[model samples]
Target chain A: MIEVKDISKRYGDGTVALGGVSFSIDKKITSIIGKNGAGKTTLLRILSTQLAPSSGTALINSHDLIKNADEIRKIIVSVPQEAKPIQYISASDFVRMYLSARGFGISEAKAAAEKALRKVGLWEFRDKLTAELSGGMKRKVFVATALASDADVIFLDEPTTGLDPFSRIEIWHAIKALRGQVILTTHYMEEAQALSDDVIMMDRGKILSKGSVNELLKGFDGLVRVEGRKRRKMAYKVGDVYVSYVDRRKAAKFINEGEIIRPIMLDDLFIKRGVNLES
Target chain B: MNLRYVAGYAWFAGVHSVKENYPYLIAHLALPLSLIFIVGVLSHGALLPFALAGGTVMAIASDGAGTAQELTYLRLEYMYQDFIVATKTGPIDYMLGEIFAGLPWVTPSIILYFALDAVYGMLTLYNLVMTLIVSVLLVVSVSSLAFLLSSRMKHARLIGPYSLIFSYAMTVLPPTFYPFNYLPRWLVTTLAVFPTTPAAVLEQGFFGLEPTAWYMLGILALEALVYFAMARSFTRWREK
Candidate 1:
């Protein structure tokens, strides 16, 4: 539902935020994974039409971001990182105000807001002042607002950043239930593995790799687990054979009676592709 | 600009303004009431001009507070952007919202001053209505100017220093504290274009010579147009 074409953003002082980065996101969840300063936020901002790119363009369902910003805005909702709540307003009132501004009637806005809050497990706290809510709850409130807007595409930047483990899992499930395209950014590999149908790994403002989980795992050889009386070690290796640096006596003791032990997940393709198992 | 959306912005601004300034509301109302009493007692009818000027200043001050709060809470805090992104309302609607929100504070001070004038038998009903209308227009113009400045400059750090400099210059430059005859003809004409000049005119109309009401209304319309244009330009410029 989103197409990004050669989009690049550079600061005035010559700091390149994104350099010819391009990706397409459809109806499923796509996770953009990278370390700090990886241009993840910049890409999301451009997609959301919040910031203009230095060059190239992003399109949402064929609506060009630069030329059709108003239409793009109507269909795309973004939850920015560290988004502060509108203080002094109750959560329910805040939601109602946002929806009402978007042209929804009071009853419709209320029902949508309530449904979104319930999805994120925040329905009970709707009447409390948003400033009085905990950090996790605040994030959930933001999430609820985006969901209640009922936009066609949702961009979440580190949506589970401050949530506890349980809340993170719950949020993941809620995200999975969303009916439209989703582009999420995170530093957690586990989050990418669990929530994303496809992963785009970025480093230094460039796309290092973009593929499914199996395709990414193909870059590494099979994992080898060695359990000993005193200690255990795991080593990744290639082919049907697994190698480890151990004492000859220990190796012999484990390989008695001429019986050969084989690694279950060993594959020789990564070795042929010059992927170093040691690393 | 949709009326419902404008009403939403006005409602939001009113609730937030009251909440943020609730603790100081008592002090705010008391200060103007106290000033009326002090001038009535000490000057004994000689301080009419001063009283009118003081009331005009109070109206502008209260309106300034409201505009400042809206700028800090709505614009800088990103609440305004949320509305912009979600709604069909444009910059004009946002500007009008600020004007409507500022009316509460400015209206009360004007009403109180007129009530005081009536109690003391210092002003007629016809003159009182004219003064109130002028006060409303002048307040809207000044508050719009303040809001325009706030939208252009996002940081709150500069607002205080700017407000201080402008307030001092306006208080001295206009024929607010003294008669317009005390100033040069060219300077007097130049200052007449400013909102503070209309405020002074309104003050004088209440106390003595009544200036042309059309002139004051023209100045107000000009101020509104200029501020609205500035705000629209600022919004587009900031997007870059």
Candidate 2:
């Protein structure tokens, strides 16, 4: 389990990335969802021991983040949001080197690298340089490193961002198969809904809400979202688009009235709470 | 120090990277070979031994100083350092890894210089051993200084020109290609701050091509430690 207490980060430029936010994760998989500049990445960076918080601290499996970062690093592997593979390195070499750096012996690192490549469906392209692979394939090479690690916790920041729909689904499946606790950040509401056992929603530098999918969706019980050009009395306007929440029984009526109807989703909550979704 | 990490990272950033991009061998050789040719012609082959020895020092020092571009690219562009930072690996491991990676770039040049030394009848067993030791320390000290410079940079694009300038300045500004006595005593002292000066002096002394000095070895070793310590502290392994 991971416990966080009053973590905050303020840059030298006086930009506050996090604001004394606190949360915990005891579930197998938790996704932090937020628009751009929402502190999702900052919180992950701090918890992964890559970035220090301006105030407060966290305990990962009882290891203090600030005082025991080296110990904490032993149990965690992180794929930062901006990670890219070396252009001249092949997929197999990249993953194998990473495993070796994490202290796996030669033969063990090779076998684990092979297993991870196969798991991520990149075995056939293992010998190809990242420059020779597609952008999606290059991204998968890093993901394969995280999969091959023996760490107790894995952190992946926007692991599927910019991927095609099929590639995204493939990564989602790989992430689902991971054995240890997984924490990821994404802006995709469906990804959170599909993968997360629990979710944390952040806006600006603060978390607006956090709970299980079922618990967070309780307020929208028996309701569907109807999006259209015509504005309703209680609809939310998102840049020229108007979205209204209606009872499932009344959803068909709105659909026939030239409005699009869909099931209520995680983003609907943000819209209902008047949260800006520009990012 | 974890020998395993050093060897692993060495193979990854050094041997593996070199194998994938063989053009680096040519890139490393192009400048030094050209300078060797120019010096041989200008001095009518009288200073060929000095030029060859200087070429080895030049090759190794420039490669080490050029590592700034690679480190900056790895840190800012690929974010590879972030992956290593989150591991149990320490700053020294990363430095050695990077050092080994850079050492390979100078291999062809080192071999070329030694072969030329053999042709000129200057390749004694003792000199060969001494030259190798000096080359290794030169790579370490200069690369450490490069790492120190790279850690302060926030962008990769700015590193290319700066590394090129720094590489040439570290080598050419000092008397790597010429006899140290040609300069006044005070100038040599100032140039000693650049690792290549002492490295070149040691190599020249080892080959008996110039007057020998025992204290130059002490200076080179001391500079290596100081630069390595500074780099380890300044590198941003754990970001704020």
Candidate 3:
């Protein structure tokens, strides 16, 4: 379980990365979605014990983030956005060292490394230098390292950022199989919708909303979407699909000779609500 | 650093990294030995001990105690420390890893140089061991200072030029290459402010030629601690 209260971060030059943001979770995959500069990474770093918040308190399994950081480190593992492998080391050796540094014995760390590589379907490439591997493959090594640690609290930042569809699906399943409290941040809305039991929507360093996908879908209920080249105050041209959110009666009134009527998808709601999607 | 056994693994990891990079290890050994041998041959073997001591100090100064290029790469280029710090690895644990990583590669070369000197009939075990001790201190003190200096640089490109200039200055301008008396007393006393100077002084003293003062030895130890503290202050663990 994790608990956060009124978390805020202020930089030396006074740029606020997170402001009074708070949430809680217990053994479930919770995703934080936001655009660039929305404080998503800052929140993850604080919760993962990577960075200390300037104000407010957070607890991971009753261990205070600041006071009991050493204890918290015992149960957590994080795959940060900037992690890379030493060019000379093979992937298996990299994981082996990582696990060893995490307190595993030589035999145990090697065994865990093999299991993790196999789980990620990178066993064949385990002996290859990490630098020689493709970027997507290197990301798999990181994922494997995280899995091998078997930590109780895991934070994965942009795990699927540069991965292909198949590799993304593989990581998705890998993250899903873990029993720990998994907190992730991603730009892909469908991924957040697919993997998270609950999603925290953030904007400008504060959480704009938080709920299950179904609960969030409820907020757009009874609203009608009118499509096909019709320009109105509520009409949003989302690619080829021109969507207009209005009252059912208003949508009916705007309907013309040939047009489509449908309910809202997460993407539509995300665009309507103005969530930062570029980052 | 946390004394937990968990941190001990960094020592293991450091050694493993050095062992795996055999190509680097080979170059590290070959280059230093070749330079010492060439210098020894050119000086008609009369300056063999000076070359040996100078070359040992050069290797130690070159590796910067393990923090120079390695820390630069870990922080600016590969950035694997991000993962380490984000995981169970603490700052001191990471420092230990950096320290141990380069020592194994450099220590063997130091041994070889000492062996070469012994083959030249300078083999009194006490003097040999004392020279080893002096060389290790020079490595630690100068490397700590280098580590502290490297932390100020913001880009990876600056690493090469900065480290080269530092290496050249520590080796060329000091008494590592000659006897302390080669320079006048005023200049020699001024140069003693450098960690490498006292280091060379101690090494030459152990060979029974130029007796080094206990005060010089004490000053070298104190310099090592002070430089280590400065390096710790310069290191950045938490993001701004």
What TM-score, computed on C-alpha atoms, does each candidate reach?
0.77, 0.96, 0.87
DockQ values, each candidate: 0.21, 0.72, 0.43
The DockQ-based CAPRI class assigned to model 3 is: acceptable
Order the candidates by TM-score, highest first: 2, 3, 1
The worst-scoring run of ten residues by lDDT in candidate 3 chain A lies at: A270-279
Highest-lDDT candidate:
2
Q: Which 10-residue span in candidate 2 chain B carries the lowest summed lDDT?
A: B1-10
DockQ of 2: 0.72
lDDT per residue for candidate 2 within B1-240, as digits (tens), equals 656678887887688788778888998888778877887899898777877777788998778766888888988999888888898887788878888877677888899889988998989999889998888788888988888888778899989888988888787777777777889989988989999999888888888989877799999999998988888888777787
**Chain A TM-score (model 2):** 0.97
Q: lDDT by residue for model 3 over A210-276, one digit each (tens)?
A: 8888888786778866777756676666655566777776666555646787656565666677552
Q: Candidate 3, which segments miss by more than 4 Å at Cα?
A: A220-231, A237-267, B1-14, B18-20, B29-48
Specify the highest-DockQ model's number: 2
Off by over 4 Å in 2: A252-258
Error of 3 at B80 (Å): 2.4
Error of 1 at B5 (Å): 2.9
Regarding TM-score, does 2 or 3 come out ahead? 2
